[model samples]
Target: MLLFLMSLNFMVLDNIIMLEYNLLTINSDMIVMTILLDWMSLLFMSFVLFISSMVIFYSEEYMYGDLNINRFVMLVVMFVLSMMLLIISPNLVSILLGWDGLGLVSYCLVIYYQNVKSYNAGMLTALSNRVGDVALLMSIAWMLNYGSWNYIFYLDFMKNDISMMVTSYLVVLAAMTKSAQIPFSSWLPAAMAAPTPVSSLVHSSTLVTAGVYLLIRFNFAFSNNLMMLLLFISSMTMFMSGLGANFEFDLKKIIALSTLSQLGLMMSILALGDYKLAFFHLLIHALFKALLFMCAGNIIHNMGNCQDIRFMGSLVNQMPLTCTYMNICNLSLCGLPFFSGFYSKDLIVEFLSMEYLNMYIYIMFYVSIGLTVCYSFRLVYYTMSGNFNYISLNSLNEENEIMLKGMGGLIFMVIFSGSSLMWIMFPSFYFICLPLYLKLMTLFLIMLGMFIGYEFSKFSLSYSSKSLMTMNLSFFLSSMWNMPFISTFGINYNPLKLGNFYYKNIDQGWSEYMGSQNIYMNLVNSSKFLQILFSNNLKIYLLLMVLWFMFIMFTLF
Candidate 1:
């Protein structure tokens, strides 16, 4: 209720509120904590808080009977707080506090289940995010040259400066990692090891979008060259995740990859200089994505922990509400007309089509959009239409009032957020008049994707000889192009091997023999000699003193 009111207030007032405090001053430079609240932050914050509230409410039933429920809730609360800090802060240093907090809390959440898979996933998530953390720290150091950590103020000024351009590049690098673009994307799907609520919150609103929000805030610093590079990478990320989602069978993982793909869309649109549209899509995506995860959680809870799509079927008859909500979210995700996604997605496509971009980018943009619809419909058919494939003893029912209530809040937003935000965010919508063929390009691709998805979902590839013929390709797509393995084992393999080498040759062998072991052996021998000499009594001591005196006299002579 508070978030709804806040959203309304921000929409009506459209005000900017700046809050700042100087933490320290050094050599006439101020290290300050700053919060810049405008329509963007207020609208995003309202969405974040609302989605978080729903996720927490849903977790009440979804995570019921767990011994660590309280801890889980606290971690989630902390995650929300960190995200809030990230959203409000305009200062780089202050943003780091939130950024690092998010990485840490998300790591904790990912590993909350005390299993090997969760542990590995948590490590991958943390280490992958640490790349961005380092990049952000570097950006902060670079921004120090400007005398203030507030990159928001310096974005336009720094555009022409070479050194600041480097900082901008660093900022983009950081955003890429946090947003899970390209090499950094492996952690996103792996992070589905976390509970569903965490998936909904982190994947949808807070964690993944942090990068997009950062890029949106720093859009002023982006050069033409930089934007092009960003566009290429973001397009690949979108296409890659979309393809990966199509191959995925895990319920939560499919959604996670979809989040990744949407994040790429957000970044790509931002690169296209439509930060407002990117922001619009981010918020709308959050609404449906969160609700989508909740629906998945409800289904997972009812299906005895099975997440394979093959195990789910005819859920529309068995669990009408869950299916209804899931279908709405999925359709919205597909950018169906009149849904929240269509408002922002349609605008982005139209604007892109009208832009003078190269064929590569144009193709990627349309193809990825089609891929989006493809995986979504494929998911819908497999989960909602087929015959039930679960074991005989499984109980599939939607009797959880708390879960339904949690979803009830988001269903309204999922249906209306895009339209409402369109009016509020862009009061004067400019018409982009395009040729009929160009205008209908998005619709054509969407329909084509649906057709392909329907055909693909109708048969199991495993039953065909072509499955063996394309086993390598299937494995690549299903494994997200071996990204999980690369991020998990590939990242650690060399480091672990180096550490082992050092332990064997340096710490245990060379360093031990030359330093600690040698010193210990020398000390032991000396102690033994001293004890033997001391045991020889006063006569020996007197003789030694006389001999020492004679030797000193001889040396002096």
Candidate 2:
């Protein structure tokens, strides 16, 4: 909170402080530990600390009676420390230390449960993030050509360099993997295998957004071509996650998918060359999304660890406080006019309206926005309305005051952070003039999406239902367009197949026959022959020698 106050003061005073500790100097290069204290870093740091603190408080009630509570708390603290390192560092080297720390610690959290599903999910999360780690390392290597590892100092001047351009591409690739964009997106939903508190902290603000923050930091170096490519991928990610969420049944997975969708929105805005808007959305998103997860956690806790929304109904009657928090977050996530999400989301859409983007991007942007609303309303219809469909023996109520209070800290921010952030982040309003139809397009899409949600919420697996007719398509969307399969078995198939072939033809087959095994057999045969000659054939050898001498004399003649 003090850091947040300091950020406000820094913004008001327009101040930046840099402190460098010179660690080692080799010729013209110096290895320095750099700390940049500006509104951006301070504000981001403050938000991390705030969300992490809230998540910890929420975990108290959520993880109650767990045997490994101390270990869990320690892991969460280390996770926050890693994010703090990521937030404040401008150097690629130090950022990577934090980046890897997040991957490692998240792997620990993801497999927190002693179950096969958790183990699989942890492996998926770790390996997916490994791609980004390698990319960042390659970028660090690329930056070495500039005589320094401090990328912040060289970003502007090094833009024209070929090596730096390659670095930019690597950096973007790294961001994509970390942000779970398109091909790397399977991990985000899978990571819901972790406890909900981990999801609140990791998905909402820290682990996933690290990519966005890194890209925002490097936004100055991107070419137009790269920006267009990034826009396409991010837009697709937004569309994919939103569509997937509608078909999803798991409460945590649905929320996780929504986080994926919002991340795509942020990445797209950043791709549009508006980092502040992305950052603005990032801060507001952290508040509400964190609270959203907390509400989901409370519900899951009361439901005896059940996460399927299909089994959840009329939750408003039993868990009124939890339902209230969840509904507010749902509305905010949909970007309703007065909510915090609306401030950032509305400005982004309106701003995009003014840009000269192609038809594909424009359609993608609007449709994705609709899909986001579509799924949110569907989730609301299933979980908040209708009759209770869960187990008859279940006890559902919001008696956990710790969880409620934790969520309460963020609930106000969820409602007001957008407006407050807009006031501070954008001292002057943007002058965006567009056609009335264009201005109304976004509102129209939101309404249409809500209607679709209502309709879809009525769908079922009954014999008469038409949804079964399109079962394949529904399965595709619900399964993330088969992304998990593709990322898992599909990705591993050819490599594993090749390995099998090598094992048959080389490692176990020809190599065994002609290499060590073959040589051993040959040596054994020769030894047997020598042994026979020396031990048993001595008398026969004398007779053979006399016969050989006679034969040799005849041949000589």
Candidate 3:
């Protein structure tokens, strides 16, 4: 039904439906709820719902036998609803509601397992997202300068206003947090602590993409400096994630990092002033990434919960269908020709090459593209080839019909979604007239990455004692440049130290001496002194009373 509606909406791209109502009125100002539905919203909503439906179906088996399966499914549904709200909302207030919903629901989903790791990961996810929530709120407050919270009405007029540039900065900050760009990226891999289905939904389609979607919508408002800043950060994020994925040992984290890298690609393109291309890649990425996670989930389920790629090998002989699907997703991730990913990714690189960019950014773009292929090939080599490294007696059969059934639904889309969306969304193909060197840069990097990835993964570096020399560098790359530690402990360490200092010096020392305790003690000593004076000396007390009476009589006179 959603696909049908989306197709129909596509046919009438000129028709836009707007719905607005006053939720609150204060004097002359009002808080209004606004929804804008054009082809973009309808198309994105259709894709989100379709992917969500498949993920929910996949969860039915993947989450089977878990104690809170129903709760899990409900949370996933709520996530989709929040994403829909985000998609349709043109009002800042309405977007906040959806944004907060995504953060809250995702935190709940991340901590669903109720374990220590889940607890930590959930905290990281929630707090990191809270930064974006705050940024969105700030943007909304700033938008009040335009007399309306609905930014869509004013984006064009306000684009050149210096006062309105702050709102753009805040919006970009919010997008960066949701998308997990650079310093805020640790939570994404941590979020893999959640169940696989949740990972598929959150990482692939909904939560992470919310930021990119925002940038796409607000692309008109960005200043040149802002775009350059975003371009640099996004390029760094892409390079960092791609490098980290090559060193990661856990299967899901590698995939999670890959998602992070692709997100950077999307943001970089958006910053390059091509919102349509960015949106195009965002949709294509969602399809194949969701399928990739499902395939990983299937492999994990069959392997008795082992996620280490080192423990997995020769799946071709064991689970042929699952292996085939896994290979398709992996190859598509590497942007193999004619696959869903190639259509969007290839176009993005070509467009970027044609742009008037510096050599630094130009090299970064192609090198990041190459890094993507590198890590992907490394992942494939580690998991899909070589001898079976698991225990020999393990039954690694792919007999779960429900799981396969869920993945089967996406297989066709994984192959064709790119081509279909391209024709539907773009009126005409982008004509790139770049030099041969620039045009073939992506292909050359891909081949180079493949060779480097094969050599890196195939050779064991630990055999030589000299390997210790690069241990620090190796650890840096493997630990994602220690971003998790920096974001978590590094952020908390200073505050905690200062808090302890204040606790001891202020709360226990000066505050105790000079606050209520000292005041009470002084009062007690004064009262005792007065009581002794009255009780121990009756003559003195009588004299004091006489004096007091005389003073009162003098005042009256």
RMSD to the hidden true structure, all candidates: 4.4, 3.0, 4.7
Highest-scoring model, TM-score: 2
lDDT of 1 at 477: 88
| Regions of model 1 farther than 4 Å from truth | 1-14, 22-32, 463-469, 499-557
Candidate 2 residue-wise lDDT at 531 = 89
Please write out the lDDT profile of model 1 over residues 1-557, one tens digit for every residue: 56556666766777668888888999987766788887788778888998999999999999999999999999999999999999999989889999999999999999999999999889888999899999999988888788778788888976989868988899899999899999888888889999998998998899999989999999999899999999999999999999988888999999998998999899999999999899989999999999999999999999988899988888899999999999999889888889899999999999998889899999998999999999999999999997888888877887999999999999999998888888878878768999999988888988999999998899775545675658788789878778877776886799999999999999999899999999999999999998988899698889999999999999999
- The better-scoring model by TM-score among 1 and 2 is 2
How much does candidate 2 score in TM-score? 0.92
Q: What is the lDDT of candidate 3?
A: 0.89
**Local accuracy of candidate 2 as per-residue lDDT tens digits, 1-557:** 89989999999999988789999999977779987788999999989888999999989989999999999999999999999898888889999999999999999999999799999999999999999999999999999898777788888888878988999999999999999999999999999999889999997889999999999999999988899899999999999999999999999999999999999999999999999999999999988999999999899999998989989998999998889989999989988888888898989999999998889888988998999899999999999999899989987877789999999998887887888889998988899999899888888999999999999899676645656658888888899989999999987999999999999999899898999899999999999998888887878799899999999999999
lDDT over C-alpha atoms for residue 176 of model 2: 96
Off by over 4 Å in 2: 24-30, 463-469, 507-510, 520-557
> Tens digits of per-residue lDDT for model 3 on 1-557?
67547656755567777898778999987767888988888888888888889989888888889888888889999999999999999988889999999999999999998999999999999999999999999998888788778788788778988657999999999999999998899999999999999899887889999999999999999999999999999999999999999989999999999999999999999999999999989988898899899999999999999999999988888888988998898878888789888889889988877788898888887788788888888887888899889988798888889889889999998998889878877877788998888777777787898998887899767646546658878889988899999999998999999999998999898898999779999999999998988787988888889999999999999
Report residue 399 deviation for candidate 3 (angstroms). 1.1
* TM-scores, each model vs. reference: 0.90, 0.92, 0.91
Q: After superposition, how far is residue 379 of candidate 3 from its true place, in Å?
A: 1.1
Pairs in steric clash, model 2: none
lDDT of 3 at 39: 80
Give the clash count for model 3. 0
